[model samples]
Target: MNTENAKPQQRFLPPPPGAEYPLMGSAVGGGSYNSHLVAGVLFIGLAAIGAIDWWLVAWIDGCLAIGLLLDRRTMNRKIALRAMPGQMLLYSQVALRAAVHMFPYYAFAFVLYLGMAPVVLPLNFAISSFVMLYGFYMLLRVYWLVHYLWVLNFRWEHAGRTFQTHQANLKTRRSAIQHVLWAFFLGNVGLVVRCSSQVITIAGFEYLRQSLNLDLTQHPTLNVHVMSIFWGTVVVWLATFWFMLQPTFLIYYRVHRTFHSCRPLYDSVHSIHHRGVLPTQLDSGTISPLEFALTEYNLPAGMLVPNWYWTLGQIILAFAGHLPSHDTNTWMKTGHHHLLHHRLFNVNFGLIAREDKRYGSFYCEPPQAASAPEPSGEAAPPARRRHAVAALAGEDD
Candidate 1:
């Protein structure tokens, strides 16, 4: 074979027309390009609020609202994936994906309510209790919505850029109808068992409360004083850290490893993610539906905090903590830890650096010298080169 005369093999090719189905995107990827606008507005809003009332939670709320408004403007730009004809189809897929992510939390919440109902009823707290439960559901919905938007936008932008190049090799596999139906059936059965146990637990609690004569009604209103906030903050932070550890380990041990074990599964499902070996923000949830569900199902487990305000605080704080993990910017260290995982699969399996270190999975190449900026009007590299770069940077076994 005359190697010099032969054509070079192409690693990344564009997807066929109308075949693109990306799972999700992230802020670290170009998906949330207008994040700076939102950040700037928030900084100003927070500064102004601090001048008037430094201790008010309303300041945080006000800044968030302004940031959302500013962020919404970015949506006005024509999003390539969103403009595709199969938007509803794509949304349905995303919806099902979201449902799987949330099913566990919803099931657990229902069980918790049933377990607490007896004690709540005797204290004449039924109405307030239901209201609080309903609020928690609504907050969970909002949190999921925020996550959806972040992933959706990133995927849209990513597909616009790379779908054409990877179209030839990018293949998507939908779960069979029978499998989906079976999953639904199993889910209902599990829910029933969970509810039954909860009912039994509630009975036990009711008996105990009655025997002890603990009048929760006397303390109807929760006293969230300064000391309470201090302790609550401490507890929420520790719990959030704990919640992340197990799930992170499970995803690496089970899902990541499983995909690597099956070539066909990896090609059809996992490869959609690894298509971009150098993962961008958009790469966060771009895996197969099963993988997505497995990795994210436990995310909302933190919402199980009994106190409504504390649960909300945990959600916000946890989200803030995760945002840095996905970030690829050089200034952020946490995201690089995860970026390394994407590059080298066997190592850095945990959520934080310490977990990988503790388990002896941590491995990273020393940081390279910064490259010079692309010249003005210069075209981006071809998809093949880009994928090649990513692969060279993080080659896996």
Candidate 2:
């Protein structure tokens, strides 16, 4: 050991548990799987039965209304008798009310439409066209409705803390490509894989419809009921997957977020998604990631469905778009929604940032946005923390 340098000391650092080694990048991307449709076969079969006898769908819608009322009463009693926070009740009430309200409207419309079935049979494509337009309105209504209540109003545990407190720490830089890739991977792959299962099913249905040339309406006189249930079901299913499948993306994006971090870009676009703190149907995939690769696959791939049915289904999907939980509600109203996630970070789930009204879309802020200045006043992103080095892999001078 004495001579010129002898044997060098062995420097060793064991890898972290769970992950075989340190995760060098901010995010890892490309562990993807296919997802498109799994509901196709079931929907086709269901649509076939419904086409043959529309009464079943009506019965189900009726039963759902009754069940919701019963559940509402149960929760109301718990709130009234036990004197609980009524947190869940607030969201439940709105959702349940919407459910019940939509039921009768749908039923009445169906009955009225049935009456005109004989005459409207000839204009089957036209009927699908109308349904598409109306359904989109319903979806948007639900999104904002959820936003007004649970998503926009709730506060978190560390509600007022900011980035200036931690700015000294994040001198190090993290690889940006990593997180961006991750956003695509989990969301694109994880979610798509699940959704593809459903998409393929619909694609199969499209193939069948083309082969069989089936129509959904029972009126035989109008060229085999021009409206086909198979197409309609695919419309709803694909749109559902498109708008409501962001949990997978958020998971990849939020994989690195912590209660204490110097960089707070997660606060910009992503934090609002986590606002619901506790997730529920009210706070489920509320944000739109439709344009992202994970979802955009619906474009060429989605063309498999009939044009009219697909168009109408997109309308109904418009309703569900905002109905689910979102992280955007806060930014929509005051841009403060995302910061809330930095504070409580775990409580508000149905959060959405409802800003613009027309031609709206799902919004995602990059994870590095903390350093960027906010265009709006009254809201300054909290300063970066020193811990950002360790987490973000630190940028040295």
Candidate 3:
């Protein structure tokens, strides 16, 4: 064979017909594939023979496993892989969405951890208690201000159709009262559980760790449990955005369907929320206590995870989603999905996923005008000037 004309021998196995070969480089091999393999084998040997802590060995192996998962270089390839322009653009969009969604949860978790971690036990308890109750008012105020600004800025471009005239109604006023009181009560209970977890981690971590016999390494000068609590909470939020959110959306789809289809439950509990024929920002918080508890299931995780900050982050994230969903101005991207649910009670239940379509409940058609039936029990109050606080509370003014 002429040397110039000799074809290079194929290095990688051909992919199955019609399958697109991944062009990205493997995260592992792009670094030092042999080096990782040697190190991993050495660590496993050390762990198996009791020369090293098993927990430490496991951690290193976990990191190596993640590296292998991320590496794309191992994919069948005949040439050096480079990301295509379209692929790069898609990755950038995914990065931006993850940052926008997860930043707030991580920020809240950090703040709660920094605030409570250093305070003395009883004082920390008091502070967290204050955060749980008083934090709602602050959150509501901030949401109201931000939403008002958003509506003002985007009203010209993205405003959605409104169902009812914006007015203060007696029924909404009464609903607002129950909303505040219910939040106050539930907040206290939730924070108590969260704070108790923090106290236990601070005072009894060693005992608890030994009792559970979990495979976690101890830090020389720090409480590993405390570290895990904060970092674990942060990691959960990160994972939620990067991997878990879509699946979680499926779960909520079932939850919403159940709440809506069960007439006894809806009439007794969930109806308080449906009362908002045209939900406004304030109506976001005007849900019955039981419903609020059901929706905010993450807060209850403190019992198992002993992560107070996780619970606090959950509170922040819940209100962040709820407030915007109720904004009939449709400022946020997904606002119309829930807003449609309020108008056409039989449809548009799940938040982000099109599960309603899959399950035969999807309905996106809106009437030409606000034709939602009026609340049956209370007479609609006349439009009237009201106090600023009353306006913030979601009462018609």
Candidate 4:
């Protein structure tokens, strides 16, 4: 019996009848619930001992969220390890490394946001909005300066790396309007909303009690109940990174796609962004105010979350996240999806491939691109671009 050419079998045998694996069972599902319980107990215990405050809780929750995310990634890797092809396995390793590299940027953004707390926390609504507007403008200008230097030193060297030859749409009336609105209006509005929400959450409770002339004095347990509600809400909101972040991104994608489809809106507003066909960091802030409001700042959590730090995180994610995708010099290959979107104009609408994959719009590096003529400043017509995308995606003509 020669076994030299035999192919190995990949068997899937079910567990024997009545078999129980308590360790695996606990790790799979019970561990997550147990963590929540432990976290709640720890939070309450710390509060009881005067060892923890809101600031501490915020940092703790962020660290816990990252831990949980990494744990899940480990579990997923274990489950999928045998199924991944060699190339895909290599890609996954690279992606993990890139994430590790990007972590410092997240930390920097966090530190920057924290640095602004002293300046913005004490001001009233009117004064804070003014400050935020000025601060936002300064932030945009500083980033622009950084990108300007980046391009000056590196652009020629990286020219071959760019997706297209078209230049960034700078020094135009459209660019000016986008800069003004994105910096002065949309971002400032979001900042003020977060600040106001924080103030209202803290003082409004006391204000309500005084205004109604009814107190928690009648029932001692009522005070406990009110406090429970307050702390519970805070804990839940703190843990939102584990739950709400993905859905928020999905919602933004849907709204962004919708705005693109609305011709009247696109022609009047959304087109301002599209003008920067080969977007650089300068174009990151070049979006219409209405589009910005409807997309980035549109999340209910932006207005409702009492944690201004969380709101600040959202702002950085919205603005800074756009920069790498818009710039060609980044070694991170994740921007290809968006650079393709800019080129084709009607595909790759989502940040990740999931949405486009489901909607039959995923264009996996068009074949013609290898020998295709140099891309021009003008974008392909909508219908032609859609056809090209459909063809590339292997859909019917």
Candidate 5:
């Protein structure tokens, strides 16, 4: 089979017309365009408003709900027009994908409302609105989950043999029980620990304040000024990128070693992610449960700032900036990098290009052209090339 010229299968249709690219350029490279300007402005406006009046969080939630509805309509139209497969199963998958994408925002809004609710009547209206909106979001998520499970069960029953063969070929060795246990433990238990630590820290601080006869209402270190909040959020966002590097390196190295070593347990888990040769937005979450715990679940766990507002800002940044990076082919290198990773497994192993570069493992497919590049007089020393090969070999030992 000649695989070089083979066209990759498409999973989801291209992102709906306007929501294709990240609002801002890639964090690694500063390249911005007009297409995402409206999204950028809207996100900034919402963040600014949120800082001044927490009540506006409800309005922000309303906007997100509207966006989700618009996305659903777009997907429905695609199905109706036969732009993509419109199987009843596909509809359920699309709905589940949307719910999964929107879950973070819904969870963030709920937390924002909990923290920002004021006793005054004017704000009480906002609180009421948030409560109602959150209730709807929860119900919708529940409905989506139920239908998703039913779809899974139906597919399992009807296509059990085929599905099992494909899954086995993918090299995923984890049993259903193991996957569920790891997913629950890492997803739920890790989240519980992270959230509880924050609560416990705050409670401990409050106890100290009361014992020392300090003002209960005053935050000792937090600068609640609007600009401070904005800048602080920015700092936290930047720091999050750096903080995630360690875990990204760990996950990549582990997977790379497992791939090379041909160990059944590790290879099976890692190969699940590699199954998506032509990746879609949905592929981002399509990983072994254990892999999910080690990678995506750990990305946000390193956050040092404990403020709910900071958490909300991170969610907004993720939705507004990072999520779209997965959908479109833009200057944002993430989508391109990930696509390359799927197609050319050994090259571009790190989450960010810099990691690959520092370890001398960076590799990208050369552009197709009629002429080759003119040879440079200077070439990398032999030792450097050897080191690069070793790094690419995942030689932690």
Candidate 6:
């Protein structure tokens, strides 16, 4: 059941020759055997993000994921199980593309960040909070787009087309206690990692409160040019990157042949999640009751910090906000890693593993939508429904 001939549904960019249908079936061993190195590296990144500073860790994560995904031209090369000199060169080129693509925007945001809070110090809280949340939505948008096109729609059973039917139900099968533990541990991890930055920031600014108290006329000296925009933009930027790929981590525990098959894609675990290609507000932390607590893992401290009495509680808020709305990858866009993990035994191993580059999947297939019309609409007979825009319509390909 080689799924590799399925053709590409929609590419973020033009794929290399064979990527169109790289995985078709359950071929256990071949030149296709996936490497676990990427998975190991990702987990290492996760542990670092959890163990050290979330801000720096998240920035590195964003640079790498965005670097990898946005650089679709070289995905086949860099993400491959075996790295050749040719692949290394391709990776360098892709990295250059990513720098060209993401840096200016990063700089603009960075420039604005320094000035944003300083000019609006009195209003920094309100502005920063909203910007951060909005930024998250954008990240998830990319997540949704990638997952929808590349990962979910290419299943061997469906074999190379998008599923139009709306999906429902995303229940998890683990015990109540397990769910509780998952939520509690993961949430605590997120809260501590993501929120600690704020605690540190506050510590840096601890003198502000005192300065204002000691001399009402001597307001804290906040550099309007450098630090202002950073106040709001940095948080938004980090939140977007940190959470956008989080589902990658959580989904790992549920799936993976190395672990137990506690969940499946077409079933409750991921079905409801894949219902929409364009995720909206409802999609935020929208998992089942058993998994609801997982949402709290990625929350930013800005929202709840003001309401809490202890500074540590504010820190906790920042940490809890790491999941849910925080994730940039939506079920529609970048959930391929999770979805593939279910439908096929190999490939798409969440954020941790991407065996797809090596072996392809059991259902390695993607083709023009079955409803694809000829370039000249006149060449094609009129159908009952208008053709849906392709997955790669706006993509680089």
Best by TM-score: 4
Structural similarity to truth (TM-score) of each candidate: 0.34, 0.25, 0.40, 0.45, 0.33, 0.26
**167-193: candidate 1 lDDT, tens digit per residue:** 212111111111122222222211221
Give lDDT tens digits, candidate 6, residues 1-397.
2323343222123334422222211211111001112322544676666744456445434433442343233244233333323322332332343334344444433333333334334443543432343244335534643553343335424412233222111111122112222222222222222333343333334344354452222344533334544456656655654443343243322222222121111122222232222222223232321222222222322322332233334322322332222132333323433333232222343333333343233223222221232322222212321122111111122
Q: Per-residue lDDT of 184-238 in model 2, one digit per residue for the tens?
A: 2222212222223223434344355345554334336754644454344445545
**Separate clash counts for every candidate:** 13, 66, 9, 0, 0, 64
Task: Tell me the lDDT of model 4 at 203.
Answer: 39
Model 6, stretches more than 4 Å misplaced? 1-40, 46-80, 84-89, 119-397
| lDDT by candidate, in order shown | 0.37, 0.29, 0.40, 0.40, 0.34, 0.31
lDDT of 5: 0.34
User: Local error of candidate 2 at 13, Å?
Assistant: 41
Identify the runs in model 1 with alpha carbons over 4 angstroms from their true place. Answer: 1-248, 251-253, 299-301, 306-331, 344-346, 365-397
User: Where in model 5 is the C-alpha error above 4 Å?
Assistant: 1-262, 297-330, 367-397
Candidate 4 positional error at 283, Å: 1.8
Q: How big is the positional error of residue 252 in model 3, measured in Å on the Cα after superposition?
A: 2.1
Q: How close is candidate 4 to the true structure, as a TM-score?
A: 0.45
User: Alpha carbon lDDT of residue 274, candidate 1?
Assistant: 49
Sliding window of 10 residues with minimal summed lDDT for model 1: 170-179
